[model samples]
Target chain A: MTGPDSSRIYTAALLIIGDEILSGRTQDANLAYLAKWLGVQGIRLKEVRVVSDDMAAIGDAVNALRTSYDYLFTTGGIGPTHDDITVDAIAAALGVPVIVHPDAQAILAGYYGDKLTDARLRMARTPQGASLIENPRTKAPGIRVGNIFIMAGVPAITQGMLAALDGVLPGGAPVLSRTIAAWTQESTVAATLGAVEKAHDGVQIGSYPFWRDGRTGANFVIRATDPAMLATVASALMAALQAIGIDPVDGEL
Target chain B: MTGPDSSRIYTAALLIIGDEILSGRTQDANLAYLAKWLGVQGIRLKEVRVVSDDMAAIGDAVNALRTSYDYLFTTGGIGPTHDDITVDAIAAALGVPVIVHPDAQAILAGYYGDKLTDARLRMARTPQGASLIENPRTKAPGIRVGNIFIMAGVPAITQGMLAALDGVLPGGAPVLSRTIAAWTQESTVAATLGAVEKAHDGVQIGSYPFWRDGRTGANFVIRATDPAMLATVASALMAALQAIGIDPVDGEL
Candidate 1:
């Protein structure tokens, strides 16, 4: 437990804040993008919570997840509207006061110029002592306080903010994966997958079954931190599937 | 806080269990479908948690959510693969022993006949004192223990399970919504939207902004339980947008 490798397992949680998402009116597009982006940063996204634009809901979830992971990120409810209460909720969660960040104010002022009203000025609010994450797509910046990062809900703005933070945070080894697919039921190869995973020390095999063209098929994704281990497990799994009279494809079918 | 309408404000939480979703290997198609389905059942999906297949992770999320809402619906991790640990994890969460549900066993046996092996038999396991939710598509039934529902990961299988559960659970008044879109910045109309929402009781207005074809636009979605109230709020919102000199469309742009 005290090994140096223990520190290599960095994890984060995302809190998606919007009524639109929970209402099924807006399909969330941020989770997969952030998950893949965090993977490239060697940080595993261990959990995600989608909550509506309620203060106590956001505050409770923020506190619960912020302490449980290496970092906590929130998206949505940071815009100028009254429903945009993320900054206030997060500030209350951290027992800090919401303040107008001068840098954010200046950025908004420059972007909007004469059109900047008090409503637009609401974008400058953040938790006390928080810094800003630049949004190249939008002038209003994202907020960062302690281990919690508050981002925009818009996919493109979120992407821009994520790009601004690339290689900025410390991370661990990026997890690698190899996929093997077959036009057979996952239940048919369940035992083989279990045995192969148990035989390997640090490999995880995930079975995703699908039905296409009136045929049942599955993709077996083997994930490991070490490239050599991943390659070895891939070969072993391919051999096992072949032995069962199923032709396995190297990538997804 | 105790009122005649209190009982009619039903709410639920969703727990999504899978590593494929957390790793970005698979985009979740279940949340939107379940959200809309639950909406039609008059259950407001209040919060959703997506966690990995790890036992402690799943167990913690289940307990945290089950007690907080009227119902808790979980999707994924009910398959036959070794990584399919939702049943055991949920049993641990409920502080109950895992038992082979007799009905589930019979169904799987009837479906697989001679092909039913040990791995396939694992689908028959459920928490002690659990009932079955019928899966019309796949023979392996979903599980219902107390207030928690354990359903399949596949979108189609989950849909079949939900169809089986139609009119089964007691729900309240279904929430209705009206959308008004305009080719204007959300910030430009944020104040008007806020005022309109404040004027209308029992209505929540959500502002979702978008950028398309080099122009910024936003959609205001007004939700209420009463159709009359919903229409009134929608009309007020549309008038407010128009007063701001933005042409409001009846639906999403």
Candidate 2:
């Protein structure tokens, strides 16, 4: 466990479903949260797709993302609307039957009591053999089969469920980061940024363009799996910005 | 002149490129904002994907979403950085080569005046036969080729470009929504929500779970294309929620 190359980066992909998402009625919040969280875990979110609610489209997408990445997470279309077809589509993608599990029904029943019915039970119907994700938001319970975790579309709900999944999921190296917003143009520190990049190929350096109150600036973010490497890169960044007479917000934050 | 058979729904797909988005360094703010905006425009954001800085991955994603959805929008990886490769990928997907567009170059040339260099000139690189979308965020412009609209990944920049594109985009109908949240459990409104769903088949009516500060509630969101229909469904929702002893937000906000 105490090896030199202890940082192992796991990979993930997201499959966003729902015609509402594709039709531009809804913006996705889960993609960013999932990507960021995974990154910090030394798990890379390699790809993401927003697709329609059509079963065939959803099926094809689920099949593709599931195969491509080590873990595949999906959001949207798990709602109680007529257009909520993610469950059927996912099951179809796996060529499995969409059936209600005792555990899932129990999860819903604990909240709904006797009010749970045929349509309400539809939420409990996941692909056979898939485990249920406890949806604290609705008690509808998302499903996970193989490497795929089907989650809610709502930002708060999806993120909450993902947080719960963290305990059970085995993650890669925990990713730590330090970002400094510099009051300098990117071009001014471009050479120094290039130097840091060339020196530490494993560490990723990104410069973001920012404008506030008619003033333009750049946010330099340095990320890596190694804590010491991050410190070295960050020191270089601060030195570069200072050398160019540009101040940067310092410290571990 | 309104026809009963007119299709009221529209759809869009999003592809996010850049190792940053994939690695979770940035939470994608565009997908949510774009979703809410498109919802107002009667378009649903159905599918979305995030890919690494890899050109092959980006190119494959571009071709896939572009072929499947009515419109495809991409954010990130269009910058002047070395990792910025969206343009090359777009060109590759379309079976074309990356070439510097004179019009785009003119925009950059005007922005920096005499400071433009070969590295900065990289921003001018665009796919053949593509129209450049006006970028209000940075000097580099986003390109639109066929159905796909390529834009920046930064929230403010992407949103600004989206606002500019809004003027010329062909929209089917504007989607209107009204939400009512109150202290009530989902079970308490399940029956009534079902009734609302049944009565307003043309509109989408669903209940979302909400919990804050030891208080629990449901957010009932009603969405539809027709103004008259939206009003009717909203009125019914008010009555239904109020009937369940859940107070309305003072005459439909």
Candidate 3:
């Protein structure tokens, strides 16, 4: 449990590797999923980097992020196609050679049976001395080298891999959040919100303005580790929003 | 005109500054919009970084990205709320003090008029010696310092700012793409696609796999600066798909 005097901070970084994302051909869905999942595990997602399939760019990003965070998760480029160069890129980044993991090969072989082709064999490759992250849905497993966890680009596969690794990582106290939405422009109640945040010592408030149903409003998300502090801040925020003549909704729009 | 020998690559990096995105409270719509918009202007969006509202993280990302790419575009954190710390962060990154730009102040004052409050005045602050990116829809303008373009986190405001900056930056030839979607697994025809890409000197192929209606398929996107080469690659890809007994769809599904 986190107290007022001491709190541990565990951070992670996500590196999304793909050319389709950069070209606007594919909308990325992995970052939000991974971030939310990490939050539940009591690890803060500190940063995210999206790089193309270029080997140099991938290598650079992996090297930069892996050392900086307690955990580094990467999505995409781990498929069987030609553009799937994440394993090679990560191998280069770690100054190691790409090798076929026996466990991964066994899993793929068992899944594909006699129909396993050379193209499918590509999925078994990983950086040397890496561990395999089990995929419940797909036979091809994700790779884990050092602090980096390499995952598939497909949202479903990424989710499955994340679920498999649940509770495996050491985490700190979980950060709790409560949202208060109001049908008023953020600028109109900005001063009041700022005062409420300043008055609260252990809470951080984030105001996200939105235009929904032809009306402008904002959602103030108050985050804190202490439940009592979060409750106090929530009440204070609700009062402030009401004092500004805007009815506060308990949740988001 | 882009020829085989003299094709120039103009690249950019986007810094998405917001905690909402990381917390999964907000789905980021800015990257795709900016990527597609930049493509029309013949600039490639190479990499993207999403950082929280923390000043150090924002400043570090800005400093790292601004010097590496031809241009750096940052969206989010430029609002009246307390979480909006992008301006101060950018100022710190550039080693300059945040000051109210006279022109920005004039615009905000004229827009807000008698209803202008201290919170609204915060929108006028920018780093010293930065130009303004006009936001026609909203009174508050975007900031531009050196090669960095700081725009609003809101999609509408960011779009307006990007539109106002149309044709302002120098660019190379636009990269054109033709997509051929086929109802077949990419791994089955990976070798043929790789061969076709190798035979074409100036063209590149990207395979994007999808699962639709409980069936697996992939889209082969052929990209090239030369129109002739792009057409040749697209035809070859279609023939290759047909050869593998898969019907090809002309465009994306």
Candidate 4:
């Protein structure tokens, strides 16, 4: 197994909380968004768990992941509804009380005016001593409780909150990647791929098979912390595919 | 916290294994498909975890989830490629040795004929004391080892394997659901929704908010094991929305 250099590697875990996602009513959009963003920031997304809108589950996952990773992010259950118990759950996990942030109250009060009901006031609540992540798309800001960053369930709003959080966390060297898509079956070139991966130091190759236009093929993704080795791996992969009489495409299909 | 009837409610946890999924290189299609399929089988998908294609991580997740739930389903890393180490991981988790099942070998032989290469033979491998889940779409079949179902990463192949294993697992009650979409923001009617949910027994209302065409609204999903309670809860939710002067639309908008 190819292991990361532990001393410099930054990692994160995302806890996606919602019954809608578990019930198949909603497809989670935040994982991919956060994964790509973290990758660019040179922080590896280590694990992702989608738990239902249950308090104990959320609390347990928060406690487990927050301590295990460099950073922990949670999406969903921050809304102004009965099921939105993320704040309470995190407080329980952190051994703290949920408190209303005056700044959050002012933001919601200005946004909704007379419509700022008690339910809306729920959005201002967070674990004690926690700061806030700015929600550029809405009045309710995302809560930052210790290492955990709790954001909205809505994709657009989560994106805005993530934007506000860009370049905030420290990270290591960004993972460099190059994709080689071949119009040939992956199994046919499996040994070649493995051999190439073994020959290269500090490089990992991932083969993703897909069926498109009534044809089956695979995309070889070469990833490494060192950018210089990516070309060597790519060239070897292309040559290997060609040796097997496959025409490799430069990018993903 | 509302606990399920321990004797009757069958729970499941999915461990999606792949570096591609963790790297955000591939959008997972198996979790939702399996969740809905398992719901129809009366099994509640309680939790889902996406882990990288690493041995220790896969082994830990398989061990934890298999013991925690009635059944555990894992997708990805079952293909005939270098990254496909799900079988080996599961075997180590079960304290068993990796072996090539004769039945699986025969099945692949029949499917691939003379084209069954050494790489293709990798698909015939599974843990000892395991049965095979038929794959009508391709040569490689899914493995059923103890409580864990090891499946392919490819979406179509995974679907075929799932279809083959459908109606095979013992389950309790099929959860029925009804959705009521309201053109009002969720916070405006959050209190009423919670009240309606509290009044209803054996029913769970999930509020999913969405913004479309400059309009903000929410879809309230009411779920219950009893089909009769679904109608009752739907009517009450409709009445609640109406009392708040918000027009509720039938089904999802």
Candidate 5:
């Protein structure tokens, strides 16, 4: 709840509400985007839960995450369809009545003009005393109630909603990262990588292995809140890999 | 836990452990593949939680999901690197000790031969009373402890582990799905879709909106365990879309 200058880390959790995702009918494109966007805001994405469109499931996850993280974001189930029950579910989770925000209804009315129907108006419903997150691409605005920000599932629309909230929430120092890749199996240099990470304070290194062009390799990502520490760790990792006769690339191979 | 023949739905939850995924540095490729694979086994992937590589995070998620679902599957953090603490974390969560499986050690020893290092042997570690989920491509096998199936982070390795697990778990009836796409805004047919779902029993429909080639459209997915009901709902949906003056395609456009 404090400002970005307070030097405390801010965290968030994402709840992806959709049966299509759970059914494997759709591959999620929102998690990576939200993670990167939150990182720029100086908030780390701590966790993510992908649940179905079931009301109780959404409500339970929303209640759990909204209490645990600094911010809780939900994507999907906010459209004008029968399956879009995000508003109703979140309201139930918050123990508040669902109300149609006057401004949201007005925006939908203006957007639809003479063709506005009851189903279309469903987009204006939100939890009591909620505000709107502007959807620049689509007329249906996203809802922001308590610590929860409900946005559309579509990547582009979620982007617009994120753009609307840019620099609005207070965040801590942005986490910085540097990558060093090598043309060797990760197991070959696991010990040195662990030792390097333990040698540095407030620095964490992640090893991601890949198989490309019939060869196995890995990329080491060093992260720290301070840029100087990140660079030092990255350099040390490169040296360590080179010591093992593995040529380390500056970035991903 | 009842078997698949008991006329009850079987469910599973997935726990994705990795810092790279939460840091926005890597996109998760395992969830969708696992979801589809579980579907074929007639086990529903009810929920998914993506947590960081921290021990406590992994342990807490494993405890939560393992109890809530019939089975819990975890991907990532099962490698030979320092960051790979999934075995230790899971062992702690289960209130058990981490032990090196002799069979896993023998397999790794046989595959790596003289090149086997301590780091490589770290892949043989698992929670107490755990069994191996064979990785046909890589010598490092997956770990299965109680209801938890610990797998590799790489897509290919995870596939091999799933293949080893084929027909091993008890599952309910396989969920079937039918998709209907129309080049019209979903709001136009929201009322009809909701009504049709209400009129049918044991059927659920999901509406996913999309914008392509500068045109608005949506795909309505109908899912049901019974093939007859699925077909009936699909026909009703197509007829409803036709009544609304929108031509619907049988599958996704």
Candidate 6:
């Protein structure tokens, strides 16, 4: 249950908005991208929430999560469709007025000439003081207000924007990890594992079970703030596993 | 964003409790599996929440989502580990005492004999009057009370217990779907797509982007409560795509 001691860790939470996703019509692809990417950069993903596009629900969720966490990421319900209400929800959450982003309108103006009707321009709407996140997926861009970034639900669009912003976002100290995919049961290595955890106070040891090509095995990942300490525990773990007649494949994950 | 319109549509939310996941030490596979499965059966996955194994957070999330949605599902914090506080959280949320389940105790007793110490036996604990969901992954089971179903975060066990409880639970009418996939920019057929959507009042026509092996395409799926309407709209969508000289790939998502 150990988390990164973020004296001011750039903590983030995700609030996924869409009834299509909630109804399971669309499988959300943003959670893993955010979680894994944030992990490497040391901006620990504190929490994640997936909610329907209902305005009340969305407003309540956004306000609650955004106020609590340092950063809040919202995906979906910002498209040019009747069901898209993320803009309204964001404004409602902040008790501000929703208005069209002049820059977003400019982005679309060049592409569609006069063909960009009211329906299409609807995507340009944003809450007060929100900045646009340039989207390569579609002309309609995502918006960021304070630390809350609202992005498209589509995986490609979300991933694209996140990649573009990853290096720029203020981050906590980066984490380093090493793992050994060991062919053994968890119980067999429990004692040594406990000792390793006890010795490395700053590191967290996690064991994940995976069925590899029809065979059952476990991946023992030792993570730490310090790379040197991680390697030390990793070396000890590999030796302990080998001593117990279990072969481990060392790899970085 | 159109969820199934049915009184039987059981709105469910997930409260995932585990620092292992939040710390990026674990990748949660349960949320998607449960969400997708529930969608097919017409049980709406209203929300999903991931929080660390903190008693206060877990308790708060359990109380919140449970009150908001028709059903609540929790995972990851009910284990033999010392940090597992799902039982305590559930108790705190429900304002009830947690007691050991006889069924769970029997299951654990058969496996561990005298080795089933207090730490191990702790798995038997559940909020008062809650029923246990049998775990195929481990001896430690999950609990359910007042529409809240708590299960292990591990995929196999969650799926197994969900399957086991399928018949006992009520569900909305299953959603019927029809899909058309082929090479077409969503913008290219926006007008016609909108027309199709307007005509098919009962059916929902959704355009999804797909790129595989460098070939770009879009999958337009028509979903509705009525099977015949879904088929009709799907056929019309295919005809329109073909009429525009757009060759659609063969498949459904």
Which candidate tops DockQ? 5
Query: Clashing residue pairs in candidate 3, if any?
Result: none
Number of the predicted model whose lDDT against the real structure is largest? 5
What C-alpha lDDT, on a 0 to 100 scale, does residue A103 get in candidate 3? 92
Evaluated at residue A50, the lDDT of candidate 4 is 93
Clashing residue pairs in candidate 5, if any? none
Give me the runs in candidate 6 sitting further than 4 Å from their true place.
Answer: A1-6, A112-119, A137-139, A178-203, A210-220, A227-253, B1-6, B23-27, B114-119, B137-139, B180-184, B188-205, B211-217, B226-253
Q: What TM-score does prediction 2 earn?
A: 0.82
lDDT of 3 by residue, A165-199 (tens): 99888788778999888888788999999899999
Each model's backbone clash number: 0, 31, 0, 0, 0, 2
Cα lDDT of model 2 by residue, B96-205, tens digit: 87889999999999998898877678888888888888888676888898998998878888888888867366556766767766676555566677788788767776
Candidate 1 residues A1-253, lDDT tens each?
1223534899899999999999888889999999999988889999999999999999999999999998898999999999999999999999999999999999998999999999999999999999999999988999999999999999999999999999887778888989999998888899999999999998999999988999999999999888999999999999998898989999987
The C-alpha stretches of model 3 lying farther than 4 A from their native spots are A1-6, A242-247, B1-6, B241-249
Local error of candidate 1 at residue A219 (angstroms) = 1.1
Lowest summed lDDT across 10 adjacent residues in model 3 chain B is found at B1-10
Per-residue lDDT over B1-253 for candidate 3, one digit per residue giving the tens place of the 0 to 100 score: 2323235788899999998898887889999999999998888999999999999999999999999998999999999999999999999999999999999999988998987788889999999999999998777999999999999999999999999989888778888999888887777878878888888887878888888898988888888988988887888888887887878888886
Ranking by lDDT: 5, 1, 4, 3, 6, 2
Q: How does model 6 score on DockQ?
A: 0.35
For every candidate in turn, the CA RMSD to the true structure comes to 2.7, 4.3, 2.7, 3.3, 1.7, 4.9
Which lDDT tens digits does candidate 4 get at residues A6-115?
24988999999998889887898899889999988889999999999888999899998999998999999999999899999999999999999988999999999998
The superposed Cα distance between candidate 2 and the true structure at residue B192, in angstroms, equals: 5.3
RMSD of 2: 4.3
DockQ computed for model 4 against the true two-chain complex using alpha carbons? 0.78
DockQ of each: 0.83, 0.36, 0.76, 0.78, 0.87, 0.35
Candidate 2 lDDT over residue span A1-253, tens digit each: 1223445556788887755454444555677788876765556677787776578878888888888887899888775545577988888889999888899888878877887766677778889999988777667887889999999887888877887776466567766677877766666566667777788868878777666787867777777778899998888878877887877887422
